[model samples]
Target: MTFVPSPSPPAVRQPGATALFCLPGAGASAGLFAGWDEDLPATIEAFALEPAGHGLRTDEEPHTDLDTLLADLMDAVRPYAGRPLALLGHSFGAVLAFELALRLEREGTPVRHVFPVAARAAAVRTGSPPGREPTDEELKARLRALGGTPAPVLDDEEMFALLLPALRADFELTDAYRYRAGDLLDCPVTAFAGADDTVVPWASVKAWGACTRGRFTVHRVPGGHFFPFAHRSARADLLRTLAQELDRRPGTAPRRPDTPEHG
Candidate 1:
């Protein structure tokens, strides 16, 4: 299926501004990050990268292949990369962010930092089986376990039907993913996870360090897998801290491997 990215809203971009692209999890749209940028500094511009089959692009078919989805995402973000950039992805989106960072690194347009929220590191080994579309009960159980799906939506058959295709495709995509050995990123990596997350353990989160030659830190928020959505105040505090940290960095393009200093 082809992908269509929603148009970005008109905005006045400040000079030397950092674009913080946030990606949502499975079955979710960019709307998931609505108002997330409100607390950030003016220098940090937060944009939600919505995938096909969700949000404004709900009419479009969802993607199943990783390569194609990445290509579409790259195309969508390329225009915004003229300035300094960062990436933050939650859950399934975090996997996308990880691969996107690798692609950007290879293309010599690496982002300043990558914050993978509620996701396991690529190098982490798990005993879990490969992913596939789940049965209704299985899907329901998963949604219940994560505690992200609202009761009203879960109770509504029509709503669940509308959501399943993209949700299933995303699960399949995550299941099909295989971690290949690759060069470590020059950019720093920060991982976020819920302290009580059974889906992604601390070891899996810590494994992100192996993916980067630069600094790596892991922050644990109090809650379960969908902690950010459940605990808004804490999430806001975290974002503010991120804004301060980004402000501390030099006003330059993201470091590329081909650059003389990095070389």
Candidate 2:
């Protein structure tokens, strides 16, 4: 099969006092957050991550595991990952962002905060998967149920055939990779979950606390699966509001070296 890489995002950017990294959901291109820069506070500048397997890095084959993807992500993102840098991801992107923060911490790169949407907490235990690859039918069904992909993309044979490999590769990353215990991040974690997200439930998301000491909070948004995309303004505003609050707090712990959290 011929390789048609994922789409490339334009260099749209906004000036801000803080930088916010936005991660898209499963089977998503960075286009999902295109207008977020204009909607959010100027105190925060926003950019999106298009994982190596897709987008500009499309010539590359997709990785079956999240860590393999993360290695590529860390290289792409490290230049931009300075202090007070924050990360926000939705669905599968959320899990990756959270874990990336932890790994960066291990590498001595401090994180300001992590905001994840529609995904479970890092500490939430997941059972071993029965399989790595899903049937083409099963992949389409999951995408349809998640409501992230457009109907035309899912229904059209040409587009569906074009997008299936990336979609299935993403599912394999989530399915085949098991979450192992890792060190805690000194940066605070903020979780966003849809009230009706079936794949990752409220209880499971709340368990994200296990990864952080006491520096964590969960916000229940009104939607299912793709809450950030569905409630764009509200979601963006919530993150902007929280990030500003963090900025406002003076001497709010050291902004570097995983500032120790209190109980």
Candidate 3:
């Protein structure tokens, strides 16, 4: 994945601002986060993460293997390591954010917090058998049910055709993922769920608490699975919560040697 800076530059980037990395869900591009930085506090700088075969890198092949994807992401995000970092990912991106958080913590960079929106816990499996691939039509039906993708795009043959490969690859990558237990994160975790989302249950959203030893919280926002972008109130609620977290923990903190038990 590659980090794409927000299009509109902030008037003045506060000194020692927290780097807020945003990741999009399957079949979505970093464009989902466009204009987020403008809405966020000056203390937070938002950067959208663009995966292979998405957005500006449309020519690149999408990654099917988790390890390979993470390795590439690690390299891509290394330059911003020392600063206070926070990750916010939606759905499929939420799982990726969790895994990336683990890797960064292991490498001695302390992540301030993790916000997994509209996604199940990392340890929870999707229940799809390995090698089970959904047909293009099935994928379209699923998208329609989810309500994130626009109706016109789904109906437009050219646009949907261009998006199909990335969609299929992303689903395959997510399905093949099997969580392996390790040390719980020291950073706090706040999982967001849509009040009306049916794709992921409340239990699954709360289960993210087990992934972190620090504070754990779950906030139910307005809208369904794609609440992060689809609903204005939901987006405002997220930015507000994020601002509070950044205010509480100013600048970067050193990584602690001891790991606390999962809450």
The C-alpha lDDT values of all candidates are 0.75, 0.68, 0.79
In model 3, what are the clashing residue pairs, if there are any?
none
Q: How accurate is candidate 2 locally (lDDT)?
A: 0.68
lDDT of 3 by residue, 96-174 (tens): 8998899999999989889899998887764467665678899898778867889999999899999988888888887
Per-residue lDDT over 88-116 for candidate 2, one digit per residue giving the tens place of the 0 to 100 score: 88877877887778788888887777877
How high is the lDDT of residue 121 in model 1? Answer: 83
* TM-score, cand. 3: 0.88
Off by over 4 Å in 2: 1-16, 130-132, 248-263
Better of 2 and 3 by TM-score: 3
In the range 1-263, model 1's lDDT, one tens digit per residue, is: 11225365345467777888888887787887877877778788888888877777779888988898899898887876678878889887887887888888888896888888888887763324764547986876776676677888878989988888888877677776777776577778777778777888777777787878876766766777777777678678668657765766543434222211100
Best by lDDT: 3
TM-scores, all candidates, are 0.87, 0.82, 0.88
Which pairs of residues collide in candidate 1? none
| Prediction RMSDs, each to the true structure | 6.3, 6.1, 5.4
Q: Name the 10 consecutive residues with the lowest summed lDDT in model 3.
A: 254-263
